[model samples]
Target chain A: MKLAIMGVGAVGRSVVDLAPDYGHVVTAVADSSSAAVDPSGIDVDAVFDRKERGGVVGSGDPEDALDAEYDVLVEATPTTLGDAEPGFSHVRAALERDRHAVLANKGPVAERYGDLMALERESEGTVQFEAAVGGAIPILSTIADFGPSQISAARGVLNGTANFVLSRMAAEGLGYEHVLAEAQDLGVAEADPAFDVDGTDAALKFVILSNVLSQGERVYSLEDATVEGIRDIPASALDLAAEDGRTVRLIGEATADGVRVGPRLVPQHDALAVSGTRNIVQFETVNAGQLHLSGRGAGGPETATAILSDVGRLE
Target chain B: MKLAIMGVGAVGRSVVDLAPDYGHVVTAVADSSSAAVDPSGIDVDAVFDRKERGGVVGSGDPEDALDAEYDVLVEATPTTLGDAEPGFSHVRAALERDRHAVLANKGPVAERYGDLMALERESEGTVQFEAAVGGAIPILSTIADFGPSQISAARGVLNGTANFVLSRMAAEGLGYEHVLAEAQDLGVAEADPAFDVDGTDAALKFVILSNVLSQGERVYSLEDATVEGIRDIPASALDLAAEDGRTVRLIGEATADGVRVGPRLVPQHDALAVSGTRNIVQFETVNAGQLHLSGRGAGGPETATAILSDVGRLE
Candidate 1:
């Protein structure tokens, strides 16, 4: 498939680097400021080299990539809150032209699913965003295969940054701030980690899950979520929970009722009590009982593989 | 799709009962000694009532259901080893007539995958056997979505009976015989649990996984697997593992190299250490890192849900 990628950050760059391995060609690549468009394929190494040296990806405007010849549009731009701008517009332009759009950006899906689906209904193109929720885990496709109604509820640790801090606090008796600082130093947490540490990141993933589970019956946004983070969890709390054979994890749940994210105590040896940055989601299936999926919740290459998987699923 | 179930066992009964909920009909159902065939949907309740009253399912021969009208043939018979008999022939009958085959029987898949695929290739129908592996966990479908070649390796606790024994031994500090007896009393383990406790059950599932992961590059069977069971695991070993923050599970692994099933020690808090009858499978992907899927590994309703999911995926 011919691809047009928007955003030259970690995920987009990784997608450009790996697309060829999946039998796809990048016809266009872009960042917020610039783009490189070709009818054939972009030179991946040269593009990254130029970006590393503090130059634009190419000479054309960023918008040019959206209009470039492509079979699928990979929306890898950073996630936004309300409007889901530029990313939403980019997806709209692709769908308006009847081209598939695979998303790494969570903004459009989590914030404006109704509008997005409305666009999809009017066009021949399809939209897939397996990368938006749990990176590298085939969560969405599994839900699709089972049919959303088959699932009763979904709950999980969807954020790596928050989990790392909580688990570190439990393992080393360290405070949240200490672990946050360590995570940032290790590049596991961003400079501005509010989205992750404050529960919005995990909540957004669950919100998207709720939308999928609801199957157009209702739409959920950040406002509909009851979110609580691990910012206030102290080392002593982990100690208390550990004494009872339990530990705290930032758990996000999505059901027919609503979406909620908070620090919940799970059994110490429970599948949900994964250590380090590993994430796990447990699904309550109607006839199948409970199902759990776990893996790296976030990473550039990991998220890219999800995006590529989404692209591969596009008809 | 119209489904003809070729067994009146637990899984087959559940499939018949739940077929209508999934918008499918059971046109035929058969047991070892009797069969019920109808051009229209079968009266499931009457069939069960007759079976419960010590009578045959209907007035037809068991072979008659094999030739019954249906869009998909559901092979839910007992799993046999050599030749994968009757079940293999049932699937062949379906595919030869250009009808899809959804299997709950592990025999045709684990013992004769190549033969099954060869039949599928020549016919216009497809074959799916999600229930033949990890019951309701969606393991096979997840592997299919990712493309088997994209996965590096797979390892997990594939048998619930063995898992029940091992986890009981670990939790209650009981010997293998005691736990096996308790499991049998509770109906968690079959009266004759040789296939499970001796590792043949898990080995067959892993062999099937190896076959799928190889993507026809190679075929694996029970003989190819190095098998070990939980009978040798004593309470003392569980105590030793617990001292080191680890636990023992009947772990089955499948990779390009080979298939292996044995009792292994894993971190107590690891995803693979799921308790009770819960089963978990971990996939090491080339780019996505480690991915784990866990759920009820075996049960009548659970396995039936997997069969239904496969039926839903049929073209």
Candidate 2:
């Protein structure tokens, strides 16, 4: 498969590295500033080498990659709220041009699921976004297999940064600020971690999952979700919860009632009580009972694996 | 879609009840003693009314249903070892006729994966057996999304009966025999539970999952796996393991080295440490890291949902 990648960040770079093993080639590569386009295939290794030496991926504008000759457009840019521009526009452009869109960016799907799916119906190509939510856990695909009506509810620990902080606070009896500092130092939390620490990251993921579980019958934006972060969780609360064999986790859940994200008490032995940076999604199906999926929720290579798998699905 | 059900057992009965909701019709149905054939569609409600009175599903020979016209064949018979016959023959017959085979029986898959897949290659129809392992957990389909080569290993707690027995023993500090007896009384285990207690069930599931993870590049049968039962586990052992913040689980694992099934120590909070009749399958993908899937491993409705989902895939 021929590919055009927008946003030469961690996920995009990893996709370029791993695409060949999955029988895929990047025809164009783009960063925020520039892009390299080729009708045949771009030299991925050379591009990586150039970027490693602190150079731009290409000399052309970023939009050049979007217009390149390709069968699929990989949208891996950092997510933004509101209109979810750039990534949303890139995905729309690809679909309009009759090229499949495999997204690592969550913005478009979480915000404009109905519009994107509607566009897919009219376009010759389809859209896939496994990397938009649980990285490599195949959450969306599992829900797709069961269909929306069969799924009663969906819940999970989606944001790794928040989970890491909560797990650390419980395990080490550390304060939230201390753990946040440690997490940032460890590169688990970003410098500006409000998106994760304040629960927006998990809320965004839940919104996307909710859209899937509802089959677009419902649309759950971040504003529609009731969000809460782990910033105020005290050590005393953890101690009290542990007495009952329970622990606090920042859980994101979506049911017929609505989508919610907040610190919830989970049994210490529950699958959703995953520690560190791991993530889990549980779907309550009427017939299938409860299905739990867990894995690394975020990472460059891991997210790239999901993107590649989506491309493979096109086959 | 038109369907021929080859077993009028629990799963088949539930499929009859639920198929209409998924836009499927039972064209034919059969039991070991009798069969029903119709080119149009069978009267599912009437078949259920007859079966409720302890009569065969149909009056014709069982072979009659196998040779009938249908777009897909649903083989939901009880599994048997060695040749895995009857179920194997049913699947083979359907594949030969270019009809899709959706199996709830594990025998044909665990014992003769290669032969069945080879037949599928030659036939126009495909074979799907999500119910063969993990009931409705969608383990095989999840692995298929990542492809075989991307998976490094797969480990899980896959047998409901054994897990139920073990969990009861640990919770109540009861002996295995006592727990097994209680489970039997509760209809959780069969009267003759060798397959469930002696680890053959979990081993069979792992074998099937291994074949799926390897994508036909590797074949694992019940004979090739190392199996052990949970009958000898003492209550004291459970107590001892719990002291180390761990619990013993009947874990089935397949890696590059080999496939094995036995009682192994797992962290009490580990996702695979699910209690009772629940099951979990974790795939260690090279790029995705570790992916965990958990759900009820058995039950008529749960297993039937898997069969229905597989049939949906035929579309």
Candidate 3:
């Protein structure tokens, strides 16, 4: 498959690096500032080298790559809330042209899922965004395979940075600020970690999953969720929970009525109570019972792996 | 879609009960001794009442159901070794007639995956057998979504019966015999139970997963796996393992070179160390890292949910 990748960040770079190994060709590339276009195939290695050595990805306009010849458009840009901007427009343009869109970005799906489905109705192509939720955990595909109505609810430890802080606070009896500092030092949390630490990241993922569980019957956004962060969780609370054989985790839950993200107490031995930066999503189904999935929720190659899998679905 | 079910067992009955809810109509049904066929749709409730009231499912020739008008064949017969006959021939006949086959019987898949794939190549339809392993966990589709070559290995607690016995023995500090008896009284284990307790069940599941992961490049059977049962695990062993904060689980694993089923020590907090009759499967992937899935592995409704999902996939 011919591919055009937007957002030459960590996830995009990994996708460019791994696509060939999966028998896919990169036809166009675009970073936030510059763009490269080739109808045959882009020289991905040269683009990476240029980006590494203080040079732009290319000298072309980003719009050039968007209009380039390709079967699928991979959107991996930084997420935005309101209108979902360039990512949403890029996906819309691809779908309008009957070209498949595989999104690693959450902005479009969480905010404009209904509009995207509306576009799909008149377009010849489909959109898949498995990486929008649980990285490479296959959460969306699992829900799809099980059929939406079979799933009653989806709850999970979605944001790795919040999970890391919570896990450290529980294990070492450290305060939230202490763990946040350690996590930032370890590169698990970004310098401006408010998105993850304040529950926006996890809530966005639930919004995406809520829309999927509704089978596009509804659209959910960060504003619709009941959000709570782990910033105020005290080490004393962890110690109290440990006394009862429980651990506190930042859980995101999406049901038919609503979606919420908060710090909840899970049994210490429960599968959802995974440690460190790991994430776990469990779907409550009527006949199939509870299906639990856990893995690294955020990473370059891991998220790219999901993007690659979505690309494969276009086949 | 029109459907034909080959067995009147628990799983088959649940499929009959749930198919209509999913907008699928059963056109034919066959038990070991009787059969019914209708081009429009069968009266599934009537068929159930007949079976519950001490009569067979229907009174036609079994072959009548096979040749009836249907888009997919649901094979849920009892599993047998050696030739994997009857089930294998039924699947072949469905493919020969350009009908998709969704199998709940493990015999045909564990022993005849290559043959069935060959039939798929020559026919107009495909085969799906998620019910043959991990019941409702969506293990096969998960691997398929990731692309098989991206996975390095698959390891799991695939058998609920064995897991039930082991978990009971560990939690209650009881012997294997005591827990097996308890499991049987609770209807968790079959009266005979050898296939499950002796590791053949787990081994068969791995063999099927191995063929899937290898994309039918290799065929594995019960004879190919290194098997070990939990029959002789002493309570003292469980007690000793608990000292080190570990729990014993029946682990089934399939890699490129080999497949095996045995009792292995897992960390007490590890996701794979699930309790009771729950099952978990972990895939070691190149890019996604270790993806863990856990759920009910075996049960009438659980396995039937898998069959229903496969039916949905035929669309």
Candidate 4:
């Protein structure tokens, strides 16, 4: 399959790295970073002729890559919201050009699931976002056909950066300052980790999942889900959760009509406690019952693996 | 799709009962029971020859049903080891005639995954048996394209009948016989109730999952997985689990070389403790970490729903 990645960020580079294994030909690559785009790339089928119109890499020169005839469009840029110039616009451009978008970007779908799905419906294609939510867990594919009408409630730890901080504070008896410093040192924390730490990242993901599982085009509000960041909880709360055989993690609970996202005191023996690194998302259904799904939840290779899994399906 | 369920037992009858909603043409129904082969005449698209030969009834003869033209065949009879007398032979006959199979019977796949897979591969078709193990849950399908490098250990409450009896004892503080009697009265525990109460049923299921996940021709042995029934632990053990905030439920664990099948004291907040009626299977993988998968594990309409879910590509 001929594929193009919108950026050379964490997830974007990971897809480029895994392209060879999955039989994907990276004919074109684009990123706002000047180093990411060069005349003579290290290894490339071809480089694009930058369209001299806008700042967004893919959004500006979507037509330059169109002539090359790529099959799958992978949008893995930074997640942002609103009508401003964001990765969402890049995704919209890709979808407009008859390319099926496999989104690792959250802003586009979370803010505009209706519009994106309408584009897919019109084009007779799919805008698969399994990588966007659960990393490589493949939760979306599982819910579509296998878990239809079976899922009752969806919940779990989504933000890895926050989860690590909480786990550290709980296990090592450290304060938020010490844990946050450690997270930043390890590159686990973003330069500005507000999206992940503030629970907005998790909330956006919850909204995407809710839109797919339930009907009605109305998007889910972060307020509907009782979302609480782990930043406020004291180290003592972690000890209490452990005393009750549970662990403190950023958990998101989505019901049919509403959702609740917050730092939870989940019991340890449950699958949520065992989830390490990024996150674990669980969906409990009436017919199929409870499912504890765990994975990397974030990272380059893991996210890359998630994107490529669907890249071959563009045909 | 024109589908035919060979066995008119619990699962088969459930499929037949749900035929109207799923758009199925029950061209034939057969079993060895008197009701299955009765002269009042079976109601369907067409009734084939009728003459009881064994303890179960089917198209007068299993051979005759295989010969009849059908889009798909759901082989949902009782499990028989070694001889491959009925279910195995029936599945083979269907394959020879190039009919797609949605297997609910474990006899053939558990014993002949390699041979049947070879046949299916040769014929360019698909064989789905999600119901053969975890009833309604799509654990098999999840593992089909699993992201985990390898499954480390999968352990959970795999039996509903046994769990119910165990849960009853825990809730009411009753003994085995008293709970067994109650279970029998509730119609979940069969009159004899040996296959379910003993570790054999769960053992068979573990073997099927082990073979399915691993890419080897090897089959699992009873010794590979330690099969201890609920009878092994006294009802008092439930107190220990409760004191520690846990629940005792029968578990089937899958490891690298073999599997471990036994009842476990899963925690209250754990997905396994929440696992009720029929069966629930959980997979612990290296890549995705711990995944708790729950479903009906057993039952008719639920199992039939599983077969119907795969009917889209039955042919």
Off by over 4 Å in 4: A34-69, A84-86, A147-153, A162-191, A215-253, A258-286, A312-315, B17-27, B34-69, B122-125, B147-157, B161-189, B216-256, B259-290, B313-315
Better of 1 and 2 by TM-score: 1
Residues A228-271, model 2: lDDT tens digits: 99888898899899999999999999899888999999988777
What would the per-residue lDDT of candidate 2 be over residues B1-315, giving only the tens digit for each residue?
A: 899998888898888888988998788999888887878888877777777786877778999988998989999999999899899999989999999999999998999988888999999999999999999888888878888889889898999999999888877889888999999999999999999999999999989888887777778789999999998899999999988998889999988877799999998777788999999888888877888888888999999999998999998
lDDT string, candidate 4, A1-315, tens digits: 777677767787777767876666776677754322322222542222232343344433544543445677788878776631456666666677777778898877777777777777777446888788878676776676543455667888777888888878877988887888888999988777788888888888887788777755356544445566767888887788788878878887677767667876776655676433656777775543455566678878777766876664454
Q: For model 1, how big is the CA root-mean-square deviation?
A: 1.3
- What share of the reference contacts is kept in model 3? 0.99
Interface RMS for model 2: 0.9
**CA shift of B135, model 3, Å:** 0.6
- Total backbone collisions for each predicted model: 0, 0, 0, 19
Cα miss at B267, model 1 (Å)? 2.7
Best by lDDT: 1
- Could you give the fnat of all candidates in order? 0.88, 0.91, 0.99, 0.29
Q: After superposition, how far is residue B63 of candidate 4 from its true place, in Å?
A: 6.2
Score candidate 1 by DockQ.
0.83
Write one digit per residue (lDDT tens) for candidate 1, span B1-315.
Answer: 999999988899899988998999889999988999888899888898989997789878999998999999999999999899999999999999999999989999999999999999999999999999989989998888787878989999989899989888999999999999999999999999999899999999999999999989889888899999888877999999999999999999998779999989998877788788888899999888999998888888999999999999895
Which of the two, 1 or 3, has more DockQ?
3
Ranking by lDDT: 1, 3, 2, 4
Q: Name the lDDT of candidate 3.
A: 0.90
List the pairs of residues colliding in candidate 2: none
